[model samples]
Structures are given as C-alpha cells and as structure tokens.
Target: MRLSKLFKNAPTVNITGLCLDSRKVKKGDMYFCLPGMTFDGHDFIPQAIEKGAIAIVHSKDIIDKLPGVIYIQVEDVTACMNQCARLFYSKPSDKMTMYGITGTNGKSSCANIIKYIRDLKEPCGYIGTIAIEYGKVRIAPDLTTPDTLFLQRKLSDMVRAGMKSCALEVSSHGLSQHRVDGIRFDVAIFTNLTYDHLDFHGTIENYFEAKSILFKELVKEDGVSILNIDDDRYEDLKECSKARVVSYGIDQNCDYRAINIHENAKSTSFDLVYKGQKYPVKTSLVARYNVYNLLACIAALHETGMSLPVILQSCTKIPQIDGRMEQIECGQPFHVVVDFAHTPDGMEQMLRYGRQVAADKGRVITVFGSAGKRDIAKRKVFGELADKYADLIILTEDDPRDENPKDIANQIKEGIQNKPNLFVEDRYEAIRQAIDNASKGDVVLILGKGDEPFMYHESGRVPWTGDNICALECLKASGYGENNNS
Candidate 1:
C-alpha cells in the first residue's frame, strides 16, 4: 500500500510505514506526533526527521519548521493515526472472524474463554488485558485496545500468521477515541455495563456511550451480536445495532440461559438452555458471573459456526483466567480465592459466589482498596457492596498513584456505614491479616490487585508480589487453621 492511498484526499503526501516512535523511524516512514498524558510527541519530531521520516503528520502546533519534509498538520494526531492504521493493515478485520467483547467487567475472561473454544478447532488470536496472542505467539499490549496503527498492524500480522479467528477486548477509551473504527465485527458482545473509567469519561451515561460505540459502529450486515439480556443497556444496544442479535442470560426470556447452577469448591456445573433445549456443562471456574460469561461465549461460538456440544466440550477442559477468581490450595483450613473485583458489581457477584461455596458454616473475608486517580465515584459503591456481603472487609492500597493511600482507603470507608471494616496501608500485610484472621470453612477474598506486578501508592510503584502470591503465602503461613483440609 502506498502512502497515497492513506491521504487520497490530501494528495501531496505519500509514504510507507507509520511510526509514532522516533527511534523506530525508517527512511519512508510517516511520523505521527501525538500528545500523551505526560509527554508531548511534538518534542520528538526533530528526532523523527533525523531518522529519515519522509512525511510528517502532527497536531495543530508546528513546533518545528522543517523546510523539506512532507509536513501535514491535522486536527488530532491520534485520530489520524487510527485512520491511517486501518488503511495500512489492508483492513485485515474484513478477512477473518472478529469477536469484540466490551463492558466494565468480563471482557478479558469472555474473550479468552471464546478463544479457548475457537483454538480447539482453528487457529485463534486474542487481544485483551492478559496479552495479545496469535496462535502460540503472544505479545503484551500497553493498553487494553492499542492505538489505530498498532491495532491494524497486529490484526494484519495475525492474518499473516494464519489466524482464522480473533477475539479482542474493546475498551471504552478505544471506542470513544475511534481507535477501532473501520473494522467490521463478526460478533459484538456486551458482558455488562457498570461504573468505571469515570476519570476519563465523566459520567455513567458517557461511559455507556463510549462502550456502545463498538456495537453502534462495527456490527456488520450479516454478523451476529451477543448481548447480556441481564444488563439494562441490552434494549438500548438492541435498538442501536443493525446486525442479528442473540440474547443470553439467566432470565427466562433470554435466547440462551443458564437454567440452574450446581456450584462447588472445584468447579461450577450448570444446565445451559438455548432455544428450548438444554446441555449440561461443568466448568473448572467459580462464580455465577462466570456462568454468564460462559453462556455469552457459547452464543458467540455458535454464531461463529461452532456446535453447542463442541463448545461445551471446549469449555469443560479450559482453566480459569488468572487473577479472575483464581484459587490456590496448600492444605489450608479454609478456602481462599484471589480476584480482580474492583467494580461494585464484580465485588457483589464474587461475594455471592463465595457465599454459595462457604455455606452456613463460613464467612466471607475480603481484602481490597480503591485505585487513586481513577473512578472515585465507584469507590463508595464498592465499599457499600463489600459491606453488605462480606463478613469482614480489609481496605488497602490499589495503585494509589500520587494520591495518599490512606485517603483512598477512607473514601472507600465512606459507604460502609454499617459493616465492620479495617484499613491496612500495605496490600501484602492486608492479605496476611485477612488470612490470619480467617478460620476453617471461611472464604478469604483477596481482591483488587489481581495480576498486577506491583502495588501503587503516592511514593510510586514498588516491587511487589502479585495478589495470588501474597494470598497463597498468607494462607500457607496460617497453618491451615480453620480450613476443611485439617
């Protein structure tokens, strides 16, 4: 593809290779000068020119006057890059099966679950919180949904690598910013909408609008759209989309529903109902939300040409996604589950699931903290939900950024007026306290951090054990005090 194809309207500039980084610039590359939260890309324009950039695409400000370089100024560099990226990749999304899963939670899990099923029959690729994988090769992405050029390039690369199916996590930021524009979706899924990313998107409505863009813009003519009928936004999305729709929920009217759940310590078995028929499925994962996730995945695969029995078989052997209700046992007295339950809905769902497993003899002890410089409004809601369901709540730091960790903890405490809550500044120490305090038949929920590599605070991120590791260490050190194993 020539640079001429990208800016057919502009005509003057034509180039190959689009790079945002100066260090990666090649002779015929078009450099995009974007402004990041902390650093301005215009500052690196000189470095890009020095590296032999033939064409320059930048924001409104012309920081440097380069006499000979093919300079082009646009209203927004990010938007232009997303457009050019789609062009550069030859619109690879049009070539293969693409599944998009969005919402506050379950995006990654649903994407991975569907990928697990698809990979059993055909080469599958996934782009989500965990990593980007094409067949056996995996690459870590900085953001949930990468910038436009990177997005196109990666999809194009997947096509080159012979991937037949791809599942991607479509983030609200990506949708609002038009990062995923121009790609047609084979299946668009909504897990559920909740309070999240209020820092970027000002209100819940705005957040929903941003997330709705995936369905609004990309649902292809003949494509299938899988929706969680349980979410209130389902009707809104149904009205907005033009594609064929399949509804899945525990609700009676849903096209695909989980009629019943038989949950246990090791797994959860359920009867998956669809079109008046039912199939029995037992997954090695906990939580009723996971049952919903599984149903959505099943609906997506069925739309993508997979049989229900094969889909259920694929689900049976698939293990849990890390940091998503991951359980660790070392012959302990009680059960411990580590999860990334940051949102109110996620917290409530996890607790409800734990309650089912622990039964009457056990209590739910949760360790969690609100993130600094994030959706502050959700903190109180998180607290309220935790207070309502959890027997004991240990508030701790979760990516405090430059904000005071104690202040963040206090904010979460604001909503838990009636529940017993304890504050611990250190996440590791909080896990230790929760585990040490928990007795046999109890369920300790180490929440928030999940799979993060480090704990965040005003001091900045430091080397830290992941939530799973910290919980395991604490559980082991507890000497199996009150667990059933003893």
Candidate 2:
C-alpha cells in the first residue's frame, strides 16, 4: 500500500511493512513510534531507522530530523496506526459481522458461544483469551487482545477464508491502548464489570471507564450495544453508549432475560424470555453465571439478525466452554472441575456452584492462587470466598512472577487463617493433594490458570501443563479411574 494511504497530504511512498516494535522493523518497513506506559517508542526512532525503517509515524515531535526518511506526526500514534492497519488490511472487519465482547470474566466463553451459534448458520471466526480460531487456524494467544496490526491481519485472513462474522473478545487493556479502535463492530457486548485488573486501571471507576470506551467510542452509532442489566455498571455503560442499547440478565426488565432456570449434574436449562415470547434452552453449561453468558449470546445473535428460534436451538447444543467450568472425568468417585475463575466475583459464583454440586456427605475442596503484580486486594477476598463455600482450601502457585510464591499465598491466607486450609507452593503438588484428599462424592474446584500452557514467572514463560490436564493426571494417579494402570 502507498504511504499516502496511511497519512493524508504526505508523500506517496510504497510501504513494504508496518511495525510497532523497533526491534522487529525490517528494511523498508514503516515503523510506528508509540508512547507506552513503560518505554517511549520515540527513543527507539534512531534504532528503527538504523534497522532500515524508511518511514516513521510518530505522535510526538521529532527533535532531530533525518533526511531521506518520511516522518508523519499524528495527534495519536496508536489511533493513526490503527487507521493505517485498517486501510492496509482492506477493512476486513467491515466485510464481516463483527461482535466485540468485554468484561472482567466470561469474555472468552461469551465470544466462543457466539462463534458456535454463528457457525451453525455460517462460518464465524473467534479471537479471544483461549485461542484465535478461524477456518482451521488456531493460535495460542500472546495477549488476550492482540495488537492492532495482528488483529487486523487475522480479520483479513478470516474474510479471505469465507467467514461472514467474527466474535472478538475486547479487553480493557486493548480498549485503553486503542488496539480495536478502527474496526467497525456491528454489536458490542458487555458481560459485566467486576473487580479485576485494578492494578492496571488503579481504581474500579477507572477500570469501568476503560471498559466504557468500547460502547461509547467504538461501536457504530447505528449499531447495538448488548449489556447485562443485572450488573452494577449497567446504568453507567448504557448511559455512555451512543448506540441503541439491548439489555439481558436473569433479574431485570431486559430485552433478553432467563427465567425458570434448572440445573442437573449433566446440563442447565433456562427459558430465555424476550418481549412476550419465551425460548427454552438446555446445554451442558452449568452454574448461574453461565446463564448470564447465554443471555448475552442470545441477545447478540438476535441483534445480528439470527432467528431467535434457531439461536435457542443452537444453545441447546452449546459446546463446553473450555476452562470455564470445564469438567475433568477419570472415573473418579467425586467430581472435578477446572475453571478460569480468578476474580472475586467469578470465584464466588464458582464456589457457590461447587457447594451445590458436592454430595450431601461430601466436601467442596478448592485449590487456587493469586498472581504476582496484580490486584492484591482480591487475594484475601478469594480466601474468604473459599472459606464460605469450600470445605477445604489449598493455596498454590499462580504466576508469582517476580514476587515470592509464599508471600502471595500468605496474603490470601490472611482471611481464611482460622479455617481448614493448606499452603502448597508447587501447583502440580497442590493439584495432587486436592485429588488425593477427595472422598467419595466430593467436588474438587481448581481455579485460576485455566488452560494456559505456560506459567508466568520471574524467569519468564515456564512450561507447565494446564490446570485441566494436571487435574486429569492427578485423578488418574489416584487409582480410581477405570482406565488407570495404577
């Protein structure tokens, strides 16, 4: 593409490539100088040019101008880069129906569910925490929300692969960084804003305001915003949105609401009440929290012009959302679940479900730990929630990245000190202990680090089997499974 396609009134130059990181700048590539939280991209301009970046796009003023290189200064570097990427990629998101889902939790499950429903009608692409999937392409995500250039490239790939729609999980960090700005989303879904990522936003209000950017700034004025009216931030997000608002929840006068919910060991059934008509839904999804995810998915599909009956029909065959209440069966007498419930709101709901699933004479055993350099406030709260609903609590390692693992566990132990709990530093051993201690009919809940393949540590990217896999291995080693050799 011509450089002029990116910057108006600039010289027409053939751009070979685009780059955000100067280290990755190739010869003849156009490099974008971004002002970031930690490092200033402007400082790397000479290095980018040194590495043969012929064109420089920057938001700040250039102190020293180099001859023979194109310098286009914009008001916002990230926004300008986003626009350029959109143009360079031929605006792939516009070619397809784009749905963006945001929240502290459930973004992955919601996005995945929407993709599954859309796939029943037509091929749909998905980009989120677990993985990026479209037309047999599966990539382990480096970030929950990839960079603008990478995101546009994937959407372009999806469009080329004959996908008519895409379900994308929009993260608060992505919103604040202007990563998803140029895409014209057809529907924006807000699951719920809870107390997560406060370390990044500093305050709950700031975190909320960051989440609000998607509805208020990104979604088209003619597009629709789907919100959970049962959430505390519903009023704020609804009021902030310029688009038409559609609400969904279990307890609210919503455009889509679930009623008469029923759950068995195998599945959950709920009636989706919209307007005056009701659609029955039954899926393997368990827990009240997932009911909210379903409502949001149904509402998004409706706004996307999918027939309500077809969507409800699709809901009945909902695929198990991996790591979000994913069950691990190995012929154990008790039940075991692996989940990505790392926040207070998420853990509370998962534990409540755990309490319900435990047999009358069984126990609800939970094993989880907080991460390093995150919202420390939630650590003790996690302990308290486990104390309330779990019969035994086992604290273990979870990305204690530069911080001491024992210290992280102690912070969580502060609240449940008087309760039945064990501090186990090694994550694998903790899982083994939890499984080994489980009696007949007991329920084991493993929280945090869901299906993540790597554990974040100070050493960086340590290989680790995922929570679900580890739990499965431990269950097999416990000598109860029919397939076990032990």
Candidate 3:
C-alpha cells in the first residue's frame, strides 16, 4: 500500500508494513516512534533506520533526519498509530459484530463466554489473556489488550477468514492508552471493578474512569451497554455511556436478575429473570462470581438478538474457562484448583468457593503469593483473606520481578493473625508441599499465575510450567492415577 493512502496529507511512499518495536522493523516498514512509560521509541529511530525502515512516524521533531526515509510528524504518536492502523487494515472491526468486555476480574471469562455463544450461530474469534483464537489459528497473547496496530491487524485477519463476530477483553491500561480508539463496539459489557492495577492508575477513581472510557467512547450510539447493577460503579458507568443500558445482577431491580441461585462444588443453577419472565439456567462453572459472568453473557447475547430459550439452552454447554477456578483431578482423594486470583477481593471469592468444595469434612489449604512491582498494599490484604478462610497457607514466589522474593512473601505474612503458614520461595516446591500435606478430602487452592506459561524474575522471564501442570505432577508423584481411585 502507498503511504498516501494511510495519510492523505502526508508525502507519498510505498508502505510495506507497520511496527512499534524497532527490533521488529523490516524493509519498507513504517516504524512508529511511540513514547512509553519506560523507554521512548524515538530513542531507537537510528536503529530502525539501520534496519531498513522506509518511513518514520513520530510526535517529536528529529534533529538529524535520514535523507531518503519519509518523516511524518504527528501531535500524538499513539493516536496517529491507531488511525493509521485502522485505515491500513481496512477498518475490519466495522465489518463484524464486536463485543468489548472490561473490568479487573472476569473479563477473560466473560469474553470467552460471549465468544462461545456467538460461535454457536456463526464463526467467532477471541482476543484476551489466554489466547488470540479464530478458526484453527491460536496464538498466545503478549498483553491482555494488545496495541492498536496489532489489534486492528488481528481483526482484519479474522474478517478475511470469514469470522462473523469478535470478542475482546479490554483492559483499563489499553483504554487509557487509546489502544481501542477507532474501533466501534456493538455490545460493551462491564464486569465489576475491584482493587487491582493501582500501581498504574494510582487511585480507584482513576481506574474506574479508565474503564468508563469503553462505554463512553467505544460503543456505538445504537449499541448496548450491559452492566453489573450490583456493583457500586454501575450508576456512574450507566450515566457515562451514550448507548442503551441493560443491567444484570442478583439484585431484583436489574434488567436481568439471577434468582434462586444454587451453587455447589461442580456447577451452579439459577433462574434468570428478565423483563418479567424467568428462564432456568445451569452452568458447569463454579463460584458465585461466575453467576455474574453468566448474567453478563446472557444480557450481551440477548442484545445480539438471541432468544432467552436459545441462550438458556446454550448455557448448559458453556465450556470451563481456563485458569478461572480450573480443576485438576488425577484420581486423587483430594481436589486441586488452579486460579488467577491475584487481587485481594478475587482471592477472598476464590477461597470461599474452595471452602464450599471442601465442605465440613475436609480442610481448605491455600497456596498463593503476590507479584512484585505491583500494588504492594494488596500483599497484606491477601494474607488476611487467606488466614480467614484457609486452614493452612503457603506463601511462595509469584513473579517477583526486580524485587526480592523473600521481602514480598514477608509482606504478605504480616497480616496473618493466627494461622499455620510456611514461606516457600520456590513456586514448584510450594505446590509440592501443599499437595503432599493434604490428606483425603482436603481441597488445595493454588492462586496466581493461572495458565501463564512463564515466571518473571530479575534475570528475565523463565520458562515455567503453570500451576495446573505442577499440581498434576505432584498428584502423580503422590501415587494417584486414573485407576487408583477405584
């Protein structure tokens, strides 16, 4: 494509591709010099030019301009990149039905559920923490919400592959950064927000504002905004959104309410009340929080023209989401659960469900740790929640990047008033100890780093088997097999 086609007012040049990282630059690629929190892309302009970049898009003036390469100056490189990416990709999002789900927790599960419902009628794609999947192609995501250029490119790919709908997990960071600026959403779902990502947003109010941008700006005027009415921020979100609002929750006043909720170790059944009608719904997903997720999914699907009867039927087949209260059973007498519950509220909810699974006959044992360089205040809170719920607690390393692992563990230990707790810096060893200590009818909950494939440290991101894999290995080592339970 010609550069003139992307930037009508700018100079004409043959544009082969678009890139943000200088290291990934190829011949004829237009390198975008975006300013980031840590490093400025403008600092790598010389390297990008060295790698045969034919054009440069930057916000600042270049003192030494390359003679042959085209230079396009913009007020904001991030905004410019978004526009250029949308134009270059032929605005693929406009060609398909798009759903954007935003919140601290349940975003991935809600996005996946929406994708699952949509795929029942037509081909659909998913972009979230687990993977970017469409048709037979699946790739691990580098970020929860990718940059605009990569996002638009992926959507374009999905459109070309005959996908009729796409589900996206929108993070607050992505919204504040304007990564989803140009894309129009057909349905925007707001899962409940909680105390997470404070290190970046600095305050809870700022976090809510960032999340509000999805409904305020991204969703089309005629689109639908599905909100959790039970959340405190629902009124604010509904007020800010220009689109039509549909509320869902356990609250009776909500547009869609879940009543007579029956949750057990394996599944939950509820009567979904919407518009003065009731539809019985059941799901294999565990936890009361997942009930909210199901409500959001039903509301979003209903807005997309799916009937209550059809949606209720589809609810019976909702697949178990990876890393969200996922179970690992190797014919062991005890049960093991792996979850990505790093926040204090998330941990409390997960442990509550773990207790239900343990049921009075068994003990609930929890193994979890906080990440470094994140909201440090949550460490002690996590400890308090663990102490309140779990019979035994194991503090271990969870991506202590550039911070001392022992110090992070110690911070978490400060809030435990009276509990049987042990500090284990090695994550794998912690899982081993937790499993080995568990007897028959015990429930072991491994929190943080769900389906994540790597562990971060000062050295770098090291290859590490996820919690599920480690728990399964320990179960095997403890002499449990498929035939052993019988």
Candidate 4:
C-alpha cells in the first residue's frame, strides 16, 4: 500500500491517505476536494496542503497555482476518489457475499431483517438508513449508500473482522451517481418502487432506471435476484436481468407466495405457499405490507439453502421493528399504530389495515405529513389518500427541510379540503388532535416519522419521537393505563 504503488494507475501522482474531513488529515494522506451543494472543497485545498497532505485530488476547473503541492487533477474528483477507495481496500467485497436491497420502501426493513438472521450464525455487517453496523461498532449514516471509498473501506474492515455477509441498502441516488460502480453484488433484492425522489430523478422512469443499475449491471452473474412479483416493475426487471431470478408475492403464480394471510392487531399468521408446498410462518409483526416483507426475506433465506422448517423456526421470534407498524397498547380499548408510510401507496395500505383493526364500532384517525424538498408531487396524493381512508385526517409537519413548514402544510391542506380533519403544523399537537378526536372504539395511526428520533425543519433538526413519545402521551391524555382498558 505504498504511495507510489497506489498512484501507479494515475497519470501523475499516487495518493496515500484518504480524507474528506481536513481535521482528520494525516501526513502523506490524499485530500479529496469535493464540491458540495453547500460548500466547495476547492476552498480547503490550501488548508489540506498546510496539514501535511502529500497530494490533492480535485476537478480540473479548480486547478490553482499551488506549486509545491502534488496536484492530481482529474476530470471528476468525486468519481476518482471512489475508484481509489476501491483500490485501497483491495476490493474486499470480492471475498464476501454482499446483498443489495433497493426500492422506495421496505429496503431498510428487509436489509435489517436479513442482517439480523445472518448475524445469528456469524458476524454480519450492515449499511442502511438505520446506520452502518459491524459487530459492536456502529455509526450514523449520512447517506443510504456511502461514497465508494467509504464503502470499500467498510467492506474491507468487515472482511478483516471475519464477517461472512453484508446487507446494504442501495439508494437510487447512489446507484445513478456511480457511487457503487465497481462492486459486484451477490444478491439483489427489490422491495418495490413507488413515486419518490421525483425532485431528483424528475420522473418515475428515471428513478426506476437508477435503481435498476444495481440489478441490471452491478450484480454478478452467479448472483441471485430476489424480486417482488407484486411490484409492477418486476416483469421489466426480469426480462433485463442476467442473474438467476426468484420471485415472491401473494399471487399463486409467484415462486413464493403467502397463503391464508390472517392479520390482526397483535400479530399475523399465514401459510407460505412455495413451489406448491405449504409452510406455516407466524410473526408478531402485523400489516399486509409486513407479510410481503416476510415473503421477501423468506425467499432470500430459501436461496441460501435454508430449509423451510429451519427458516420458520429461526424467524419466529423476530421482534417488532421500531417505528414500522410498531404497536403500543397501554390497556386502551382500541389500538394505536405507528408507521413510516410517507408515500401515497404506503398511507393507503396503512389505513386499510387500520380500518380493519378498528372494525365494527371502532373508527380510524390518521396523523401524517409530507416531507419538504422531496417528491413534493406526492403531497397531494398523500393528502387525497388520507382523506379517502381515515375517518379523521390530521395533517402535520413531517420534515420541512429548507422548505417553509407552513407552505408544505398549505399544499397538503389544499388537497384535503372539504374533508373532516384538523390542520396542526406542530407534529405533536397534530398527534394530540387525532387522539382527542378518537373515542373508545377508535384506532389512531401516527405515520411518517416511524422510528426516527429527530424532527427536521428549515431552521434546524429538533428532538422528536412521533411514535413512542406520542403513544405514552396519547395514552395518558386518553386516560388509559394498566387498569383502564379492562
């Protein structure tokens, strides 16, 4: 790993140390001058060189008159740094099984589930929305998929730690940006694609193209393509994939399908129909979406040579994923469910289950909001869905990053007009309003934030827990306790 040998592929010089943060710069390290949306890295080149940086990798446009510094000017520094990172790590992903799960929703859940099961036998690494985890070491993630260099280093570190497998969440933004260009996937799981990130991709087609890159081009020939046939994009992906395809859904024609889907407030039990054979699988996790997620996980385990009985036995004790259809009952007469269903389709599904759980005398009241600066096109759709399903819609602020919270609320309000609801921009107040509107036989669904701990706004991120904290307060507000419901 000598500096000279590392930069042998470069036209001019080789870089030794890798760095993004100048404060962490080491002697002989290479500093990547990335031009972020907020701050330009070119401004830090002098500071980086002053801190004993041997060379600097930057775009040609930023070429300056730093005579002493070894400048490795490239057409694109971001792309080059990623390439160098892979080289520095000795391509460790080659030795390990890497599973790439992509889609609008359930990617994090499915990846975490697989990681949990895999870790039961051996050390399993994970990189996703939750965080990047390897054994006891955990770090909050800045992106769903880290930059290529960070990714390679993490993979190398996991391999050195005797980790057998890694479950990685591949975001469409990362895939389309060539951030994961060189890595080969051992398995690619598609949860389902829906309208999201339209502000970035411009259209759903472009978004799908970005996600398809992992399966269409990134996955290895011997890799397994775990697909949700229930997704509308499955047929197209199947026709284009070179890897071995395995399909799962509730549809009988699928390779793996769920049968007898019995879902209630406490849990869901179902018979999994795979290849004409039936396998019973029961889980404390409720909701029809979870049934699909379980099917995806089961399909992956099946491909790994795990017997149906073994898979069922191992996955039986799976705990409720925090903030994802997470249930909190403090002896209430009815139920309160929390979900990260921000999208229109997800909201509809959540409401469908909420109404089912609130059958007969019960009613369904929903509290949710659209995120700012992200897929604004879906705001009206989300509002329309909430209006159509919930007995009472409480529109509140979710994440109003860089966008006015009132403005975002007004957009959603426009669509939900003429409907019976409350417009409380304060998320906690919105939740309280929903709870106050609910009666003894009523269910309340708090959506959008899920397990997230922070409430993001244009001003700053504030401490908030829409689900867990709200549940306790709502219960107290509703006069429910251990002795109340009975």
Q: Which structure among the candidates has the greatest lDDT? A: 3
Model 2 lDDT, residue 319, Cα = 74
lDDT tens per residue, model 4, 346-436: 8888999888888688888988888888888788887787777778888788888888777777787777755687678888888877776
Write model 3 residue lDDT over 97-208, tens digit each, in one string: 9999998889999999888988988899999999999999999998999989899999999999999999999999999999999788999999999999999999999999
For candidate 2, write residues 294-370 as lDDT tens digits: 88998989887999889888877887777889999888888899999999999998899988888899899999999
* TM-score to native of every candidate shown: 0.92, 0.97, 0.98, 0.91
* Superposed Cα deviation of residue 214, candidate 2 (Å): 0.8
How much is 120 displaced in model 2, in angstroms? 1.0
Report the lDDT tens digits of candidate 1 across residue range 87-122: 777889988899999989999889989888898889
RMSD of 2: 1.6
Off by more than 4 A, model 1: 9-16, 21-27, 35-44, 59-65, 73-79, 459-462, 478-485
- TM-score, cand. 3: 0.98
Off by over 4 Å in 3: none
Cα-based lDDT for every prediction: 0.84, 0.90, 0.91, 0.81
Question: lDDT, candidate 3, residue 23?
Answer: 99
What ordering of candidates by TM-score runs from best to worst? 3, 2, 1, 4
What's the lDDT for candidate 2?
0.90
